[model samples]
Target chain A: MKYNVTITIALKEGMLNPEARAIQHALANLGFPTESLSTARLFKITLDATDAAAARETAGQMCERLLANPVIHNYTIEVE
Target chain B: MKYNVTITIALKEGMLNPEARAIQHALANLGFPTESLSTARLFKITLDATDAAAARETAGQMCERLLANPVIHNYTIEVE
Candidate 1:
């Protein structure tokens, strides 16, 4: 099935550089722009996985590993 | 421009009857199921308005008039 995974994350309030902050911070510290930066929650990411479980797992991994901070960022996933 | 107004509202965390609660309440009290309802935030409401200003205005009215409760439900409008 074609699973639609939409991830929405708001910049932690009071954090400067929502659009470029993360990228620039990474660049300044690590000397490179992290590839996972996104504009806002208005993102639509599509994945064709075998089933809902697999899709959810993939999304969860992405969120935990790269996309969001488990401490401050919370996410809701819908598998359709 | 073809304006795309997507409204997403979550059931208040403590409120019961998310899917049928609002409808049932309206039905029990007002004697009919209210027409305005939705399943989570997976809503895509499309409108072809004349301009961005008009589209924003229309969306604002809809939020204030029906779709969301200003106190709890917040909305983001995108025009494309």
Candidate 2:
């Protein structure tokens, strides 16, 4: 089954500034660098996953790993 | 100015079941009725608002007036 997953990740209040810096560091470590991106709190992602369960699992993983900081960030995932 | 506004309203926990009924009632009151819809906690909305501020304000109004329960439901609005 194909599952459409929409994951929204946002920096918690007072975290956008630092989170953008961290995101930049992470990207540069991965050999890509960019500048002048919005330090907005919200990011929206749309993707197709293998199945509903897997999609949820993967979305959770993505948020924990890269999209959110367990300390100051939270996320919500919707699978349809 | 043209603003793209996306408003998402979902039933909060323990509210979806009743909210759908309320939504149906509201719709019927507005001269439309339907059945066989999902009482899911997540909704996705896309529209164009007048501007960033207006988009945010309208999104909040839609949620408070129709999309969410002030008691049980909470929402986040993102304007891009």
Candidate 3:
């Protein structure tokens, strides 16, 4: 079966995110009273798997091995 | 008031996505029978706005002007 998967990766809470800060500053400069900003990365993958369970397991392993940095990132995988 | 916004940016349908292709190939090579993959960029922003309506408008404009490329990318904004 073919599975559609989505992985959302984000920095762990309390981690300093300079990119978000820069975006907030940019918004402020653009006349938007921005106080703060946070950013996340989303990846969508379609693959052939035996079942939804297998797809989820594979995707979670992918996140652990490559897609997310365990030290600073947290990721969630959804399979359909 | 403070508004939390999420902007999801993605390549328009039918566009060639080399990054997705690369990820698919990587997954296939990793012993996952990946047939295809799609990717999207998600940005989370927290800002100060007058109200939800204003926040939505500002975020939509931001996506239009800076966050997303109109020709090749489509974006959606959600304000909370």
Going through the candidates in order, their DockQ values are 0.02, 0.02, 0.70
True contacts kept of each: 0.00, 0.00, 0.76
Q: RMSD in angstroms, all models? A: 19.0, 17.8, 1.7
Model 2 lDDT per residue over B1-80, tens place: 54444444444555546544664465445533333222333323343555778657755765565556778766767667
- Residue A13's lDDT in candidate 3: 98
Clashes of each: 1, 2, 0
Show where candidate 2 strays beyond 4 Å: A13-50, B1-80
Report lDDT per candidate: 0.53, 0.52, 0.84
Among the numbered candidates, top lDDT falls to 3
TM-score on alpha carbons, each prediction: 0.35, 0.33, 0.89
Candidate 1 Cα outliers beyond 4 Å, as residue runs: A11-40, B1-80
What is the C-alpha lDDT profile of model 3 across A1-80, one tens digit per residue?
88889999999999999988887777677776565678888888887788999899999888887778999999988888
Please give the distance, in angstroms, between residue A47's alpha carbon in candidate 2 and its true position after superposition: 5.0
Error of 3 at A33 (Å): 2.6
Candidate 2 residue-wise lDDT, A26-73, digit = tens: 544553333322232332334345577876886677557554677876
Candidate 2 has a DockQ of 0.02
Collision pairs in model 3: none
Better of 1 and 2 by TM-score: 1
**Candidates arranged by lDDT, highest first:** 3, 1, 2
Q: Model 1, B16-68: lDDT tens per residue?
A: 53544543354335332222323344234455567878877766665565556
Q: What are the candidates' interface root-mean-square deviations?
A: 17.7, 16.7, 1.6
